[model samples]
Target: MLPAGLHWIERWLPGFTQRAQDLGAVLSGTATSITAFDGRLQAATHDDRHVLLMASRPFLEARIRERVTALPNVRVVRARAAGLVVREDEVRGVRHADGVVEADFVVDAMGRSSRLAEWLGDAGLEKPRLERLRNPINYATALFERPTPAADLDVAAAIAVYAQGLGATGLSVASLNAIEDDQWLVLVMGYGQERPGRTLAEFRAACSELPGVFAQAASGAPTRDIATYHQGESRRRDFTGLRHFPARLVGVGDSVASFNPAYGQGMSSAALQASCLSAYLTSGPDLSVPAEGFFDLQQVVVDAAWSVSTGGDTERLEAAAGIEPPEEVRRQRQVLRQLLEAGLVDPFVARALNDISYMLRHPAAMADPALLERAAAATSATPH
Candidate 1:
């Protein structure tokens, strides 16, 4: 369904991706958006990351439960988190309906609906400041399967929204992913467009503009009715920036930052966050008041993901706002656009870009003097 960084899998959860129905390489494309032509340069896959065909949500949840339940030190409690139990400025533990349970530290991984802000306020502490990019995007996803393979490429797919002027045009990108069980996960994305095709007919029309394989595979059999999901501006709660934070308390996953789901970084990013925590526990000094250093390290992790996800969505964000972005944003975007165009034609550039996409390589890899020199040269020589 998606490719994951090998670092997370090998270090944290070995054989996690093995539960997938199969393993496949991801294939992607970039298009001109409006014309619906597949003539743009094809994207290259990276060897470091792996494309996994995972089971559906329910099955994946069951697998997670099974593995976690077997751990001798783990206890699975299905209780609501009433709030935090703070003794003065220190976080003692978590409070539930039954009573109080204490711990050396507590990680609030309650996801996007995390009640951390409420708990912080209740404990007489200011909540973390939130930084947001209000693109107000929406997506409609549907599952369509075929009795047989009719697609030219049976991997993953992506469409890049074209820019008509200095800023992005008010259109969006769309995609269809080849999932396990011979099914395709169809997604129709809009920047501020909000409405994606809802009914089967509408969903088909949405797919009509996507790659042909999406339509052909989707036409065969109906796995389930079309489904829809909506997400507003991507948010990063600057927990690291909070001045009134307590020790022995931290957050992970969406609690720290909720990215645009379209990027598919939610699960993997959380895993990486957990990995960071592990590193801190093993090497860092004892936890005390103002773990600002740990939060600083976490910010580094979040910054990597934010750059990739937000950078990719530049067109949509600019388009939705209908304004020219800042000078720095424009300059970086133009450079990235050049690299993208160059990647379509050059394998090396493609590899570098793909690595950047998976967050396996720092974004600075795109700025390698040699690579940029080569890409600029390649762009000039080629016809636009």
Candidate 2:
């Protein structure tokens, strides 16, 4: 999976510099030309909106493993997941194939395939309400040799292809992430019924269809064949709304909310949820697990991610399902559409959007008094 922007994550998890010492540079306007609102290719950097770090999953995972194990009372275990352990409605621990391990508090960070709902039922607790937005997406990714660094560019190209919900098919990104070694971790994304090719010809065609920089970078050779991942929808189990849910247990990552991969939010959302858990542990009710408080904070994180992702999904839904988005959702889309159109021309809007996308600011903060006024002026000045 791709890594999130560094500023926020670096704040939470220090020592990134030493861990991924060879991490690549950020993709800013200064880095390479980027395709933005209405297919207008332009530079990607601004005052607040700039490139973040570029690192690979293995590099990050290794660092995380090292850091976590170094903790005073932390143990790193490799075990097959069986299910949760619970007494009445409070979760006590986990049950694996070999044996059962107990804990004062438990967390389920399993991804889209999590069986938390089934575990709850097995433990005689009511299952949380599950919500889903169907968006069949398929894509494949592989590592390739990194290109020679471009003149005047920081690292390499990171092209973002935004959909605006107009096309039934939306291109996600051409992320040619320059990583630790002289390798580029490139991912090609597609939506709805479209699928990334499998055969050599198909894969080459898919690569050629991406932005020029990505296509040229991958034109050389691939470390592996095209691999495909499929998911039907974005889902959330509404544990936060349950009054009698289990205590001493929390759901993180996709067990809580699995956003459509097209939005590239799964990891970032989980990190934000991790921060929420840390907040509760550090400051809130110490001994007794503040499960409710954690859920409350976690919900805020999920809501923001869901809004951004579902905003794009709803557009696809309209095309795929022939159902109209709610009036509020439509209005929000219209406002955001205007913002996107004006953002490239307006510096303030660009910074606001970049911060929101990077999770440094709340999505609702898109409506800041000054931002709204500036955006409106920019939109009005445009010849739409």
Candidate 3:
């Protein structure tokens, strides 16, 4: 989780972060920095004040289940939701194999394969507009026992990105995180035709070709075989713009927007959306009408993540197709490139870039005159 998401979780569920940390979750601090490489030079940044949490998906899920099931008002149910119980365009409950479970509000958390749209359509409600970006990204991840103690690792996380003229050799992106259990979770990603291999030998060879950190992490004894996944596109459903929507029903998490996982924004985005829902409910909203307020708050988080993930994918896709972007886009890319270059040697610029990359700040923060002036000066003074 990023700092923004972690903050909200701590706010709503007090002591959640501390409990996770006590149970061996790795928290970002002065000793844990995230380093980024542009196929050449590298820069590192860390947030000592607001730290992020790192843990395996299963571990996180188990922790959440433990906390939620202990709540007095909450009951854990094991059943499949076959359909929605809609009454006069408002969802009243859910239908399962056994019977129906009623609720005042229904949250669609079925992830990317959610059937909410089809259900809504069957109920004679207007479907939300779906937007998709064809990314065609493939990822392969491997687990390894850390070669050294956690304290001795150079950085907690590192990412090497493919740049146009930086001598990249078919590798799109490579990253490794020092996760819990003294394990290193390393991943390598590629575009449509440049998929990473599934064999252990192929994984090690790819790591060797990447930066030093990747090779070092791969040197450790393998704890698990390579696991692979493919994402065809990044997508979002425009729920706010829909005219005929149901009341007492809302969507969260991947049901709203699922971006490229390479950016590590999925969980954070969902957490922030939950925070938005909390805010909307606390504001005493009208339950008879649509959840426009929640959707509006959620849109801001979705847009920030979409821009960060899709912006890079679109650039790579366009470049591979031998297509040049418009003049305005070219100018914007140029400025961004300058800021990235400046980040290598300037601490302030590096932190700013890190904040933006981690979704702690919006992309518009890059346009601050102070940041632009510093980036310009740093770019001029630094040597490539």
Candidate 4:
């Protein structure tokens, strides 16, 4: 099930495999008090290298804590940032539960509910205009121990089936995870036109309707009660255009933009943003350079994730209203549709699709002349 032509590429990137392993170790020690839960996981393959065989949030957090705790500059403080303490033209510090913590650089990793906007208001900075597109994505996900070894479960096979739904404008995926026990997280997802049910029984029925692999994976395995999450839309904060910004404060992760979770881009996007911020710090404290660079990098990350999530969103004809995509982005959408459809039968197309999904390749890779030609040829020969 490894997509054709991708194994070699994945061997180098290892896509999420190493990252997931690193994350698991850190989080295990960071959130040691709370019980680790398995709500959802991702399914991906990059160039057939098999990026991540299986991973869970608990594992990822443990990985992060183990690695990050050793860093002298990194502090795992248990408090929420309530506001920014800014003056005249720059940020002096951030206000947390304990009190304002003064720092030369402040990176907000506060997820979506960031207080940066209010803090910016305190500094004479214009709040980045926010545009939201509502798709009303809702789903009930549960974890179950796999009846067989996780090595027996195929991540690419599950994603290939999900890619088929993309052809019809729907989405579904079943992936393996290594928590306390080996397990497979089966998710039956519906987008605008194919959104899932709200109630537990309704969601269970939807799960039953998925490919036999899902039901088979869950069969006889102890299943947790379905937990539901509903995110109404995607929101992007326009930070790059702001001329007046605090010198010391910058936001990261979902604080900058929160995509529809169905695409599973949350953690990956956050990691990229964190890396960008880290990179900016090495250039010294110029403020303007890294601040602008931070937002610019964030926009790039958002654009990449938005392209895939919105392409999936568009299939939901009912949810398409009020969703205004930039007019210049036409080619990416067309290529994505082709990739999904082509991925149904062509392993090469699928490999390319996974690479793009995991942020391992630029969207332009989908437009390679040879790729387009193969996709076109595949579409002509294959019937939907």
Candidate 5:
């Protein structure tokens, strides 16, 4: 998880950070840095101001479940959600095989394939417009056992190698992370027809094309077979702009928006949305009305994540399809390219870019006039 998500978790569940560390979550020190390579030169961005926590999804989810079930007001129900129980333009409860479990409010956390829209249509409510970015991204992940006496490892906690300018290379992106249990989690991603194969040899061959750290990490004994997944698109359901919606019903996580998992923004985005819900509830809004205020707050979080994840994909996909984007879109892409070029050599620009990438700051932070001016100057001054 990113620092932003961890911050909210620590706030809501006191002592979560310490507990997670104790339970084998690898928390990077403040000195941790993320190294990025763009097929040619490399740059390292220091996370001196924030630390990221690297833990497997199961490990993190188990910890969350342990804490949440301990709450007196919450209960663990082992049942499938069949549908929503709506009455008088409000979500009154959930329908399951056994019966309906009523609630004053309902949160749809059923993930990317959430049936909330279908249920809403059944309830005579308008469905939110779904926006999709068709970028066929395929990725594979493999786990490796870390070498004994961990000090022998040469790589940092995180490394990202991009295939931006590499000509005709099947690979698009590759990364490695130092996780708990003295293991390394390596992932290789490709776009469209470039699929990362699901074999140890193929995984290592792909890593060999990447930087040295990836090769070194892949040399370790394989702990598991490579697992692969394909995402056809990044999607978001526009609930904020909806004119007709049910009251006391809200969506979070992938139910609201699902981005390219490569960006690692899903969990962090959901946590921020949960924080929005908390803020909305504390404000004592009338439950009889639609949760427009909550949606407004959630939209900001979604838009930031969506922009960060989709900006580059949109540009690349459009170019590959032989389609030119609008003038404004082209200009925005040019500005971002300048900022990235400047970030390679300018610490200030690097920090600002890293902050937005990690969701520590909003995407709007990139528009700071002073930052733009500095980036432009740095881009001009730096030797190509």
Candidate 6:
């Protein structure tokens, strides 16, 4: 079961499913690669037992935009940015190609290509510090129709396969409504070590190279057009770590930190950050501590998401150097691996894993010795 509070994933998934159905579309495909800790290829394909949980990227983005724009206080703008304007160590506003937009407070929500820092530098404000993720990843995806028999099957229970070094990761997911119209969603993700092909024939060939489940799914589908998105590396700016920041401005969403899209934490992180900002803003004006409080809250969300993404990145042998997760994190991940492995076999465990994976529960809660002991007991009791 999903968590009680509404999450971006839940909200976006339904909107995407509805949009696809409206357009006579079915499932969307996503194949994400991973670097296993054991230094081996771990690729997954579309025909796997678990293809129902993934949705199309375009639909997902559209749904999120729809929800964000509906907020009374939120306004959406479509224009390229020119730069930021500041004076006397305080933020004045932002300048875009269309015109200058000034407000009592200004927020930079731009993604990885944020020009806020450069603008800060130009305005003589302190430059923000940057930390990049250890891995570089890319993605390609398409939609497909599921086989009649697979329709209505559980797609959320699907598992992904990660190939360590063979041109990114190969995996497939079946969206919530993909089976309603007999379709599925598939994505191929490229990791630091592996890069997947982009063209249709090449993508099919790459999927064929994966495990039987993925290959069968790719080979079985009557596919839609293909698309690609390049979002490499996870980046975080140390705004909280800075001693001085402009009082009249704040940065949120990808402007503050961006995770590898493969980790699927970007949207969730942004939601949490926005929630923090809302709370800070609702508390009324406090020029004395608004910026610091905002960053501190954002760091909590970023650190939680980064811990998981970076942990996985470090496992990839060809990952960028200079990032070595602490031993404690490594050990904790071992326990998580066991849970995931168990989840692959037990439906109950899968639900538990899903709950934690979606950030419905604290990561530390999963580490309870009782849960580990229960998992061990359950594993031993099962037939070989």
For model 1, residues 22-63, the per-residue Cα lDDT tens digits are: 332223323211112133644443454433333455655565
The digit string of per-residue lDDT tens for model 6 on 23-100 reads 543333323322132222223333222212334556546655786678788876777878876665666677888898
Worst lDDT run of 10 residues, candidate 2, spans: 164-173
Better of 3 and 6 by lDDT: 3
Q: Is candidate 1 or candidate 4 better by lDDT?
A: 1
TM-score of each: 0.86, 0.87, 0.95, 0.77, 0.95, 0.74
Looking at model 5, the pairs that clash are none
Global lDDT of each candidate: 0.67, 0.68, 0.83, 0.58, 0.83, 0.59
Worst 10 residues of 4 by lDDT: 28-37
For candidate 4, write residues 301-327 as lDDT tens digits.
778877777666654542345454565
Residue runs of model 2 more than 4 Å from their true location after superposition? 1-9, 23-35, 42-44, 47-49, 149-155, 162-173, 207-210, 284-290
Flag the better candidate by TM-score, 1 or 4. 1
CA error at residue 320 for candidate 1, angstroms: 4.5
Error of 5 at 101 (Å): 0.4
Model 1: residues >4 Å from true position, as ranges? 1-6, 22-39, 43-55, 148-171, 312-315, 319-322
Misplaced by over 4 Å in model 5 are: 40-47, 148-154, 161-169
Q: Give lDDT for model 5.
A: 0.83
Worst 10 residues of 1 by lDDT: 29-38
